[model samples]
Target: MIKKEDDFFSDMYQSINRAFADVIKEFGGFEISKKGFGFNPNFDIKEAEHDYVIKAELSGMDEKDVEISVEENLLKISGEKKEEISDKKGKYHVSERKFGSFERSFTLPPEIDSSKIKASFSKGVLSIHLPKNEKANTKKIEIKTE
Candidate 1:
């Protein structure tokens, strides 16, 4: 079922939106789904006593499929998830799983010690530990009233 409207502005807006989405698609910015555009995996960051911990959900991906690196103040995590293939081909259903390459980068704070960072991936979860440097560690300063 399709409904056409005589609204010129709305039609122009839709055309612009589609063109923008096409550009994004060309650059692998996101994957268009029924709901909307989806980008990257879900992740969470937590600040601890001496380190900042980042955990990203990367289910169904092996360690060999993932890569992590740090340059300047940016930590990059990139990987590819291969799509599964079934021997018997019969398609007429809903397919929502995302299978492709993805890269995610985070700009770390200046207080982080890049040299002593640690990363571990286990059970579909990628965890990163960024220890704070001595200068960036918590310090107590005395207040002087003049």
Candidate 2:
């Protein structure tokens, strides 16, 4: 019974994921229309004590192909993933990988220091660190009783 339930939930989750992907393909965001490709890399944004870190998973992509920019509070990550299908190889029996260009934009908090942003790519993962401004640093406040 447990196995059946797990399978049912897994199937439902997969269905939802497929549907979401279809929607993304149908309605691309940012530079989706310009690129004519439907590949959006997954990313995670985290907040630390003095910085905001964004990590994006971009398998099969070179660091040179990706570009990062920050304007005001808008952060943009754009890249092109070249198709790896070799002309020398025979027709693919199954091709599931996607190729082309994709861009994702995020609105960062105003407290971040865009000038001090740092970015690094390693092992198909892109990490961006946005240092917090001096005014944004955490500080304890005490209330004085009158």
Per-residue CA lDDT of model 1 for 31-146, tens digit only, reads: 44222122257889999868999998889888898899999999998888877878766763655566667787899999899999999999999999999998777777999999
TM-score of every prediction relative to native: 0.68, 0.71
Question: For each predicted model, how many residue pairs clash, with residues at least 3 apart or on different chains?
Answer: 0, 0
Off by over 4 Å in 1: 1-39, 89-92, 140-146
Q: How does each model score on lDDT? A: 0.80, 0.82
User: With candidate 1 superimposed using the best TM-score fit, by how many Å does residue 36's alpha carbon deviate from the native?
Assistant: 13
* Residue pairs of candidate 1 with colliding backbone atoms: none
Candidate 2 worst ten-residue window by lDDT: 29-38
Residue 43 accuracy (lDDT) in model 1: 87
Tens digit of lDDT per residue, candidate 2, span 33-62? 334235678899999899989999899999
Among all candidates shown, the one with the greatest TM-score? 2
